[model samples]
Target: MIRLMFLLPILLCLGWYYFLRVNGVPLKQGKRGFIYILAFSTLVLGFFVLMMHLTNPG
Candidate 1:
């Protein structure tokens, strides 16, 4: 379940980028890079959230 949660964000981001590319939307390189970073951050945040809850499991 934890791995699935992390993968969800990444897959969604990839689908979004693919949609944009297919539509021929010319996104700036910086913006594209930021999106990738944000997607990865989403995955990291999921991990942190899991850890936080586990640490305080009450």
Candidate 2:
């Protein structure tokens, strides 16, 4: 369960990259895309952690 939390963002970013590549998006050409991915992944991870903490505060 904990491992999945970390892996989920990586998989998401890979999928996002593939989607962008397939659609011929040029945003990945600059740091903007990388920053977006990082921000998105961080949000996802933080959300998961927050939920887990809220549910299992021990």
lDDT of each: 0.70, 0.76
RMSD of each: 4.1, 2.7
- Model 1, poorest ten-residue lDDT window? 25-34
For candidate 2, lDDT tens digit of each residue in 1-58? 7677777667767777787788888654744666787898898888888888999958
Best by lDDT: 2
- Each candidate's number of clashing pairs is 0, 0
Error of 2 at 12 (Å): 4.3
1-58, model 1: which lDDT tens digit per residue?
A: 5546666666666776787688787666436755776768777887788888999958
Error of 1 at 28 (Å): 1.4
lDDT of 2 at 33: 66
In Å, residue 11's CA in model 1 sits off its true spot by 0.5
Candidates' TM-scores? 0.47, 0.58
Give the Cα RMSD of candidate 1: 4.1
